[model samples]
Target: MEENLSGQLADAVAQGADEADLARARAGDEAAFTRLVEPLRRELHAHCYRMLGSAHDADDALQDALLRAWRGLARFEGRSAVRTWLYTVATRTSLDIVEARGRRALPADLGPSSDRAVLDGNAPLTDVAWLAPYPDAGLAGDPAGPDARYEQREAVELAFVAALQHLPGNQRAALLLFEVLGFSAAEIATMMATSTTSVNSALARARKIVAHRVPPRTQQRTLRRIGDARVREIATRFATSLERGDADALVALLTEDVTWSMPPLPNWYRGIEAVTDFAVQVPMTRCPSWRHRVTSANGQPTVAFYLGDDAAGPHAAWSITVLTLRGEHIAEITSFLGPDGFAPFGLPASLP
Candidate 1:
């Protein structure tokens, strides 16, 4: 009972401090505003990424939202907590970007899977807004609230984010605010400037689409079940197989129904045979040499590859291959190719 009382007292004190900061921020104290916002920044940025499906877009949206919040600070009535207000601003900003830029796509979303390696003219589709992987460093595990459905990390999984791209801006915003962030329908209606009925309808439609696309079991659950050591072993062996051009060793790591895709390439291979054909033809035989550093992306085991022909020369950044596991086998290989993926993971452009 005493501990409960003490916690309540601490909350009251923090609220008082925040009230003062709010007043100062409203009065144009930039430092006060920074203090008020710093605590909630990471989660808000994640929310933006979920809404927009790209870390780069999330960065721009969060920056624009914070700018809007700062400029409009004087108008904040203090009815809601600062976090709620900021989320409202961020959600609207992301929605605007979504409408303007449209949704991002993966190679699997483009068309049918190829039965064999796409050897010739397989150029990156520069025009398409591809779904970039989120760097999970320092990402939180807690849900936004008690009512939130998705834990923070689970929500950013590549499959979840990719599924979100199929949703319209309003449905995406409504679903994320309600399910992922734990806001009430009425609250989401206010944040999105829509009716509660509309929010409910959007949630229904979004849930249907997402349920169809995303696997029932989340990657977080799979990783937890598989354990860290085993997961690391699988990722390392998968990378080693590529580095040594060992097709049989690589095949042993994958599921019979495994898929391989390189985004912006507009071609994907499904089933072990098709994936093997691509692997054997391209990375194993055609590519000269590979060096890899194991990493994680979208809450899955990932390998960052560096490619170079010369044994003594620097290996240039190639792709960050994220592995989605089913039980003990590798089920999906999403290699987000190119250097743009490296900077977010703090990986170097090239390795010697």
Candidate 2:
């Protein structure tokens, strides 16, 4: 529907001036509506993701926001920039979704770190609100706005998103609007239908929790410091080591306090010894075959792996592992094990 309307909006633009397009859009021209919102789509979607912590949830919230914006377009009095108004709608919609469901979480949030690997792992918890990975493809990486605190990529990093989930819905919305998207406290208060004092208080509380949780340097900054070629080299080395079941090679890539966690399976291992022991027992000794392709997730390196045997034919989809780096060393490995992560990468069900 947006595509069809966008095409019509293009035709309308070809016919006249900017004023004409605005008139058409206000008069319910779907094409004009599309044109008005298209420029803001990516940022708005990102806002929803920050508020909700799941790309899937962000999609739903964004769609609802657009719909509401369309219906309310006639009431738009030109008091604020269209972008600001749209964000207001998107933020409110995300808050609604948060109320209905809840914030998503990582496995580490569920319980203490396992000293040893839980051999069979645990069953996939359907009811557990697990944090979903974001696909970085097609993102423009543009800054949110002039006053935005975080770059587009920085806002989506795994650590940042996970920390956001820890805040309450209102505080989360307030912080994103003020710090991430660059809205002023007074402006955000208007958007949320509250006082500036309340918005400021929310921002302060949200920042405290996030500051406590997130690492000092963002993944974006670290990736830039390392450069792209070195980033790929590190990810490729880890994948190759895993495929060959080379425990030593794998350990060589890890930091002394490296951590590995496979969500939906509550157990996670911390430190070099625990991680290496888990790797040797499970992925190295038990899994007969492995294949991998390097990918990106949350502005950091990721590896999508397949596991099976030669005789059984093609390998089956396994995990989408995202590595967290502390300089050149692999600090954390979040292998999102399940078919759920496979689809986002467009991976085949089996590899022959």
Candidate 3:
């Protein structure tokens, strides 16, 4: 099978590959090139996603970077490891994309959070560049490198990626390369065409901004502290409460300061009182039937919900709600409303 071949090739590369395949790849052998870079594709795509805040943008950036690498592979002397060189190319490519398009944002960034849920959800903001959810299924389980400050799962948490968008492009790249990808200052300077001191300065500023925006601990660490079974129990209980229209049960699981937001809808709520009111009025009362399957997204517990009544046919895909926990309680709920999110998680389009 293809997977077996890829595993064999990765093993071969790990044991020490010769210059033969590199030469073939440089000479325009597509299969040879595929073999050479296959091991790194997942992580490279993740890096692009982190930089751009959208999976679609990451796909384009990664494709462009790979094409550039193929064309320039011949010029690659024995200066650096292939992984580092590819990352340098990918990082610069992402920077170029950032220079043109700028950062992505959520509804919260557009304006202040509404104290009460807007009963009539605003028109979907098609024009705004919003952050997209990442399907955690495809993540590379290993850290980018040994020196990475964050674990692989820790780096891709929703809050971390959202906070990253607040930083400028150069600062973003510097911080990612240093803290996430584990590139040393000297190496990152070479990639960014800047001095080590400049890289350090950028990293310091980026870190300060990120620290204030992101929580003190990462979701991955919190999940580890809670254990998988407890996290699943919370997700299942929340989903069941919605299905039964049990507002009290839902409120019991949420923190006093729990926040809820639905993107594209531009309506959000903070605190248990506001969230409960929104949940009862909109989700529970409006939608008559509910079905949910537990899933994970952006390194957090999530539910893929379907809503409909017998008169309307099968239950249709509704939203993918990602939960942010503060210890045992749900601290934040980002319910990304729209059926478009369903396919990525391999969820059913309709539940009978």
Top model number, lDDT: 1
Runs of candidate 2 exceeding 4 Å displacement: 1-19
Between candidates 1 and 3, the lDDT winner: 1
Assess each prediction's global lDDT (C-alpha) against the native: 0.92, 0.85, 0.87
* Per-model TM values vs. the true structure: 0.97, 0.91, 0.92
- What are the candidates' C-alpha RMSDs? 1.2, 5.3, 4.0
**Which ranges of candidate 3 are over 4 A from the true structure?**
1-15
Candidate 1 local lDDT, 120-231, one digit each (tens): 9788899999998888873763347768898777898999999999999999999898888899999999998889999999999999999999999999999999899999
**Over all chains combined, what TM-score does candidate 3 have?**
0.92
Q: Write the per-residue lDDT of candidate 2 for residues 163-231, one digit (tens) a residue.
A: 999999999999888888888999999999999999989989999999999999988888899999999
lDDT of 2: 0.85
The candidate with the higher lDDT, 1 or 2, is 1
lDDT measured at residue 101 in model 3 versus the true structure, 0 to 100: 89
> Model 1, residue 116: displacement in angstroms?
0.7
Model 2 residue 237 lDDT?
A: 97
| All candidates in order of TM-score, best leading | 1, 3, 2
